[model samples]
Target: MSQPGPGSNHAPPAARTSPESGPPFSEAGGIPVDAATPVTTFSPVVLEVPGRPVDLRMKVSAPATGDNLPVILFSHGHGPSNFVSSLHGYGPVVDFWAAHGFVVIQPTHLDAMMLGLREADDPDAPAYARSRVEDMRHVLDHLDQVEAAVPGLAGRLDRSRIAAVGHSMGGHTVGVLAGQSTADPADGSDLDLSDDRVKAAVLLAAPGHGEDLAPAVAEHYPALKATAFHGMTTPALVVVGDKDWNAHFSQRRDWHCDAYSRSPGPKSLLTLFGAEHGLGGISSYDAKETTDENPERVAALRALVWAYLRSALYPGDRAWADATAALAAMATPVGAVESK
Candidate 1:
C-alpha cells in the first residue's frame, strides 16, 4: 500500500509535523496508554562462538513480569559514540520496547568501538557487515542459552514470534535478514542471508538502492554502494527521517526509503519531517549523536513501534490499525503512516 503521502495528505495523520515537532519511530502516533510494565535489563549474555573474533556479548531487556512475550532482535547503528554502538547503548529504544512488553535483545556487533575486534577501524567495513548478521543468527540459534542466561526470562519468550529492527548501518543487517541482496565487493559473490524465522522488520535510516553513492562512499564503502532490496520479500515498516542526509553516504536522502519503495508491499513508511539521522535521539537519550533531539518525538516513536509489532505478531490484535487510526485522528501528528 502506498503510504498516505507524509506531507501530502490532509487527513488526521496528514497534518505534517512542522520542523518544530521533530521526527521518527513507532510510538502509536497519538494513542493513549494508561500504564506500561516495569523493565528489567540484563547485560553480558555471553555466547561462545568458536572461531569468532571475540565472545559475543549482548544485552537483553524485558518486562519485569510477563509470559509468552514476543522478541525483538534490535541491532544498534554504528554511531560515533564509544558505547552507542554497543549493547549498552540505545537506552531510549531498548527501554521503551521492553516496557511495552517485548523481549528486546541487543548484541554488541564486531563494529562496536568497545570491542575494537575488527582489523580495520572503518565503520563501513564489509567484514563488520557480515559479522553483524551472524551475531543475530547466533542469538537465534542459541535462544535456549540466551533465555537461560537472563533470570526470569526463560519460558516467557514466544519463540515463534520474532521480529528484527535496526538503525543506520544496523539497518543494513536487518535488510539482509529481510532478503535484501548485494554483491560482496571483494569476491563479487552474492551475499544473501535472509532468515525464514524473522517474521517482520523495521529499518531506520537504512540505505536504499545504492544507485547514487557519494564519491567517498563508493570508494570507502563498496558493500553499501551496491545495496539492492529487490529480494527483501519480508514485511517491514521502513522508518526514515526526511532530513537524514549525509553527503558522505549518498547524494539523496530518500535513499533511506529504498527498503520500503524498492521492496514489495505489505510495507509502510513513517516519514518524519525535519528529522535527522539520529531520528530524534533513538541511538541514545540526550546523546551528542542525536541532531534532532526531542523527547516528544521519541515518545511517538516508541508508541508506533509497539503498536506496529503488536499487531504484526498477534493475529487478533488491532494495535497497528488502531494506532494508525489514532494517528489519523491527530490534527498535528509528528508524521504520517502510509501503507502499500
Candidate 2:
C-alpha cells in the first residue's frame, strides 16, 4: 500500500480510563500516574526491503491523541513458538507503552516460526543475528511510512527520541543496535550494527558474551559465541530474574547481568526476586510459558520500564528517581535497581 500523504484528516480512537484510576499504586512503585490516554493500534503494516525473501510486516500502537510522541522499536525474542515471535506478540509491553504515550513499532523478524523459513533453505535468513539488527534499521528508515499507516499519527513522532527494546534473543538485537559488537558467523570478521538514532535501549533477559557459554549452549547457538557487549555504550536498563538459571547457558544464575556488568557506565540493572526468564510474563498475557505469573510482578515491571524510558529519554524527568526511591523505601520490595 502507498504511504499516506501529509494533511490527512484521520479520526482518533475513543478515550479510556487512566491507569491510575483502575488500580492502586502500592504494588507498583508509587510514581504518580497520569490519566490514561486511549491507544490506537495498526497491524500488518507491510514494508519490503531490498534482497529480502519475505516482506517485512509490523504492528504500530500509539496513544489516541498525543503530539511529539517518542518511538520505541521493540524486537521479539527468537522462540519455537510461532505466536510469540511475530508482530502479534508482547501485548503486555506494547499496550502499556502505547497507553502511556509512546508510539511502539514491532517487526516480526525472519526467525519467527510463522514464516517457516530455515537456514538450510536459505543461507542468509532473517532468522540470523545480523539480519535482526538490519530489521530494526529498516523500521527506522521507514518511520515516515509507519506514521503514514496510522491515522492521525502523521508528523506527531519525535524522531530524535527513539529507543530500542528487546527480550532474550531480541535483547541481543537491541545490544547490537546500542553498540554491542559481534563476529559475523559467515566470515570471522567483526560486525558492528549500532545505529546512532537509538538514543536509549532496554535489554531484558539478554545473554552475555559467548565466551562463557556452557558446552551445550555453545554447540546449539554458535553465533552467540561471537557476541560482545564492550561497545554497548548507549544508556540502557537491563532487567533480569534472580532465579532465572539455565543449565544449558551457564552455571551461574547471575550470568544474565553480564550485559549491565560488561557494558560501560550509565547503565542500570533491575533484579526481580524469584522471577524467571519470562520476567513476570512480559512476553504475553497468561501464556503457559510464564513460570512467574504474578500480575503484581508484571505491573511493577511495566511501571519500572516506563519510568526508566521516560527518565532516560527526557533529561529533566525524575520518574526513575522517584520510582527507585519508592522501591527502596518499600518494606518488602519486589526488586532492586542498581546503577553504575
Q: Which candidate leads in lDDT? A: 2
lDDT of 1 by residue, 226-249 (tens): 578878988898998887776556
Candidate 1 to truth, TM: 0.88
Give the TM-scores of the predictions, in the order they appear: 0.88, 0.89
Worst 10 residues of 2 by lDDT: 2-11
lDDT at 123, model 2: 34
Alpha-carbon deviation at 86 in model 1, angstroms: 0.9
- What is the number of residue pairs that collide in model 2? 1
Q: How many residue pairs collide in each prediction?
A: 19, 1
Angstrom error of the Cα, residue 37, model 1: value is: 0.8
lDDT values of the candidates? 0.78, 0.80
lDDT of 2 by residue, 1-340 (tens): 2111000111222344444545553334444545568899998899999987789999999999979999999998875456887899988878888888899999988888788774445434434677788999999998889888878899999999999999888998899999987767677588888999999999988887777877755655556777777789999999998877775677666678889999997999999887877787787876555666567777788788888999999999998898888778878888999999
The positional error of residue 276 in candidate 2, measured at the CA in angstroms, is 0.0
Global lDDT for candidate 2? 0.80
